[model samples]
Target: MNGRLRELSREESLRRLASVGVGRIVFTHQALPAIRPVHHLVEDDGEVVIRSHDRTALLSALDTVVAYEADSVSGDDRIGWSVIVTGVARRADGADRYRHLADPWADGEPGYVIRIRPELVAGFGLPEDNGHAP
Candidate 1:
């Protein structure tokens, strides 16, 4: 699909990601793996926007590369899926711009947004390895 890029079905991959809203946001701080659980919203342009406070550990390096991992699973039901989006991160500034696009919790105090433009997006369905389980 989508010109045969040797990837998972576009719809399937996107579905796996869209189905979940909570996941771990992995970023590098001092060259070490730093992951924080986050709630994100996916944009139409295929970008993920995560909201957080200025003091959040992940905000230390806005210029660094980041990878966000979101997954959904029901072990009792024997169903699960995970999606990883790897990209560069940058702080989203500007009131109007952020207000229209950003969704931050915690009263917007020192509010900051992390925009991740995935250069590589991988999705996996667990327990069955269906779609694109990676």
Candidate 2:
């Protein structure tokens, strides 16, 4: 397995992130780092949007900094890419307009729509080598 690691450009990273609808949002809870599996949509402007329940911990995290990560990897081939976006989270203004964008896997209504404006975007990938004897 001979392959080189590469840094994905901002565009490529965003593209890869956008290709997937599920990711993890990391934040602080009770003074400790917490992670939540969430479904997200990458807006045309490069912002990320997700829906949360009114009573969830994420509700209190509004206006705070958080990190969102999305990745894909082939376990057998050991090749994949990961992207992370660090940004501030806030409640979106037009909830009605973007309500359809929130598609959670769980049942029940998501009472809040949150958006993350990326302050930093980074990604990396390992391009796999073709099957051949070296």
What's the TM for model 1? 0.71
Residue 114 Cα positional deviation in candidate 1, in Å, after optimal superposition: 1.1
Best by TM-score: 2
Native-referenced Cα lDDT, model 2 = 0.77
Model 2 agreement with the true structure over 1-134: per-residue lDDT tens digits? 23477777888888888988788888888888988877888989999988766346787678899999988856565547788999999888765665666556545554677899989999887765221111
lDDT of 1 by residue, 15-72 (tens): 6666556667787766777877766777777777777664558766587777888765
Best by lDDT: 2
**What is each predicted model's overall lDDT from 0 to 1?**
0.65, 0.77
Query: Residue-pair clashes per candidate, as listed?
Result: 0, 0
Candidate 1 — number of clashing residue pairs? Answer: 0
